[model samples]
Target: LKAGVVEALKTVQYMGIPQMVVTSTRTEVALLKLARFNILSYFEDVLGGDQVSKGKPHPEPYITGANRLKVPTKNALVIEDSENGVKSGVAAGCMVLHMPDLINTKLEWNNVIYGALDSLESFPEWLSSKQFGMWV
Candidate 1:
């Protein structure tokens, strides 16, 4: 777990985006073990599920993330690969990008999704075009 977290931190750092690991109460202890591996400092904030009133698919987690970043919900971009995660991000009024990775499939899309990208590698071009207000 620690090695995985360390690799994840390195990846996120390579992308130049601030990253944090949000865990639920049942998994906080696991995070502690992960911290022992010295990867905790890579995250700006580490929140436990008990800290929020709701859980996944409820918007609270992502909402809390947006709050921590001091960014408006609408301006926040959520990259979720699960149906529940997509729903939660939408409920929080965030601009969500649905990536159907190994954990997700075509059946998950129900029309409410803003956009779907083929894979992570496609994000940079898509984001740039969207930022320029060109929906090509």
Candidate 2:
């Protein structure tokens, strides 16, 4: 996790917004990471690779997250770092915010991405902005 991510999670939690972690990693590994970062309690649910039949670039993982959260897929916001994760989120009907990490290439499926963010530190401010209101 980034420096401000925990603080952002705190703000989100304080606002009573529901959050879920949908990852390609195994459940145990995901949980370990969350625990290591002391962010395990922020998420309402964590759906990992083993929990889904298909992985990234397929809709199954993100769809399962939305279903587990009991919200419509269209209402979900997925923050992803990879192209396949972005595809999964888009395929599941969720708005995806891409914060590119190791991958530096331009996204070919530009239409599918909601927006590309500069950093995770901007997430909280972005969420409070009018543009984010339009998204919700």
Candidate 3:
């Protein structure tokens, strides 16, 4: 697993920040992966590729996620690790934070992204910074 995923989830849980998985992976497969990693309980919901007509870069997934959480897209904060995910979140009107996974983030995205995270491990600090005025 990537570093600090458990800690990040715990931090968010402690802060009462709701989260959901909006992944291109299938729901069943994603659920199994989350279960295998023992992080299934951290998410409020999971929107899989199979569950949505459109996937990343289409905004449908992120839009559906925010709708499921009963929050407006403008109020949602999307932490993405891929270019397409970032594009989708931006297209959905949510604040997007790029945490590069295998691919290096595009420099041009700096103009559009709300913020950038070095890794998921840094989520606590990022949230605590209050740049976007997080409740916690």
Q: Give the best candidate by TM-score.
A: 3
By lDDT, rank the candidates, best first: 3, 2, 1
Model 2 lDDT on a 0 to 1 scale: 0.83
For model 2, which pairs clash? Answer: none
**TM-score for all predictions?**
0.62, 0.90, 0.94
Q: Give the winner by TM-score: 2 or 3.
A: 3
Residue ranges of candidate 3 with Cα displaced over 4 Å: 131-136
Off by over 4 Å in 1: 1-43, 102-111, 132-136
- lDDT by residue (45-118, candidate 3, tens digit) is 99899999989999999999999999889889898988899999999999898898956788999898898878
Q: TM-score for model 3?
A: 0.94
- In model 2, the runs with Cα more than 4 Å from the true position are 105-107, 131-136
Estimate the lDDT of model 1: 0.67
Ranking by TM-score: 3, 2, 1
lDDT over C-alpha atoms for residue 92 of model 2: 95
Determine which window of 10 residues in candidate 3 has minimal summed lDDT. Answer: 127-136
Per-residue CA lDDT of model 2 for 1-136, tens digit only, reads 7756877787677666788899999999999999998899999999999998999989999999998888888988898888799889989999888877856526575777777777778878877663444433
